[model samples]
Target: MSSLLKPFSISDGPCESGAFRHGVGCSKSLHSPAFDPTISHGATAPGCRTGTTRTRLGCTPGIYHTYSARRTLAAASTGGRKVTHPGKAILAGGIAGAIEICITFPTEYVKTQLQLDERANPPRYRGIGDCVKLTVQDHGYRGLYRGLSSLLYGSIPKSAVRFGTFEMLANPMRDETGRLDNTRSLWCGLGAGMAEAILVVCPMETLKVKFIHDQVSLAPRYRGFFHGVREIIRDQGVRGIYQGLTATVLKQGSNQAIRFYVMNSLRNWYKGDDPRGEMHPIVTAVFGATAGAASVFGNTPLDVVKTRMQGLEAHRYSNTVDCAFQILRNEGPVAFYKGTVPRLGRVCLDVAIVFVIYEEVVKLLNNVWLTD
Candidate 1:
């Protein structure tokens, strides 16, 4: 009995959780008792926790093994440590915004030109290349970046606010299972989009359209970024900076809602079990492109309305409704899809690049900050 109990006394680490099977097989000894040492010595399983039990019982030589519970990692925990830093979303979003504008501003310029061209008129340029060529011919190659300053000034904050809001909304709205479900993600995006639209996107888009559409001559009305902003405020008051608030809200809200929903779906599909699994950059880019494409198709009509409403000549229309009606009446339904090709190209590539850069920057920042 002493020898049989000796095996159970070995001090393994404390078992927080596990199943301990007590296999007591008594020997067929009518007069004497037989003890099994193997059964007395409990074997620990990976995730099993067994409480200490010292019983002086007689049993046959049966092997005893601990069955471990499946240990699941939390959603926020990564390979190194749990996520502790809250600024990661802002930093990542800001960096991605800056990079995206710099790389895709040219395409954006061309797309805007295509969208803003008056259908009733003979047309300012034949097509996308012609538009580009004419702009270069008239205002030089730098014309492609006519409104870059406005976007640069607003993009950082806009993206920061958008992503920050997304994180805030998503964390709280996550499902009971601690997973960010598609519906919650969509709501998160919608909230982020609306926040950004009201705070930064509306004004930035207004300025961008004013700069791009109102081409600058030697002595233009709106001289530069600051001057343009001042003129808009002076002429239209603070309201001028948010000329297309309604259209912008619709466009941005739908944009982010679709983007986040699709992106979340793709990411979850890729990382089936592990929510925090790190995907390759290429895979991230592909997912981002898919999301972007979906968003573009979903909101391009609203984007067109927004652009028209924010243009310098927006006063011609009373509001978003009037603008949409005018476009349908004057330019036909096809007008709603202006710049589809260029926009699709720019947006897909832009999203892919932005997400790749954003994820990489966040990872690097995590290393730099040693987030735990």
Candidate 2:
């Protein structure tokens, strides 16, 4: 009988052993000395050992304590890592962008040249293969990177603004568990895209397009990045570098929204409920590539319009809507996807490289700087 009665003791109740069903009718009087009534409801009691059980219609003190400790640790770790630091994001993004542009500029050059080609009576190049052949033949292999300087100059700031803005916007959207949901991530991405477009991408893109177009022109005027920038400013003022602001914003905003939405969704799925989970670099690259492909398909039309608006012949089109209208009416709807193939390749590699580098850089920075 003493053995049977032993289980009813305050220190060895059914709650501690998880013997009670639904924790129903479990008396507070049977609670251990560690279970303080003065403690707030649903909070952990001091000195309680964690347990997978409930008591008095709520989680046992031990479970509450375990959960509380987990939350505290999560908060401390997150704070210590400074994951949302704008400066860190900017540095990482800039480094990633610089590296990515260097590796992928050839594809970017091809895409730009293709978009600028207006399907002349005698097309300058037959297709992707012909374009590459002619560029290499006429100007040597370096022609494949004709406008690299302009892109490199802009890529750093563009990516910096993008990631910095994203971290700033996303930090607030995270839940108590530090997880960012897909919808909020999409909005944050859009905001980051718009910010980067306005702050850096438009002028940089306009310069890049003009440089690439000039390279293929009968008389290539600009000698270098500075020279071209000066000439554009001398000829058209500051607006010359911002030729397609509206189109750029639209394209970039949609681009990031799609990429980040897909990326966040994939990450969430991969991580499940573990917000602090880390992914392998290869896995991150694959996810980034998928995200890039999604963005390319989703907004290639806007990208084409943006390219055209920033090209040498931009004056022919009045505005964003007019550019699209003319392309649809004269060039046919297919023209909207003119550089889809090259753009797809460049974007996939670019996104994958940028994300992988950015994540690794952030980790490095976290180790060096241990403050929020």
Q: Show the lowest summed lDDT stretch of 10 residues, model 2.
A: 27-36
Q: Write candidate 2's Cα lDDT for 247-325 as tens digits.
A: 9999999999999999989999998967788999999999999999999999999999999999999999999999999
Query: Can you write out model 1's per-residue Cα lDDT over 31-135, one digit (the tens) per residue?
Result: 111244544454323333332223344332223222111112322343422232448888888889988889899889999988888798778778899988998
Local distance difference test, each candidate = 0.79, 0.85
Angstrom error at residue 112, model 1? 1.0
**By TM-score, who's the top model here?**
2
Total backbone collisions, model 2? 0
Clashes of 1: 7
Instruction: Score candidate 2 by lDDT.
Output: 0.85
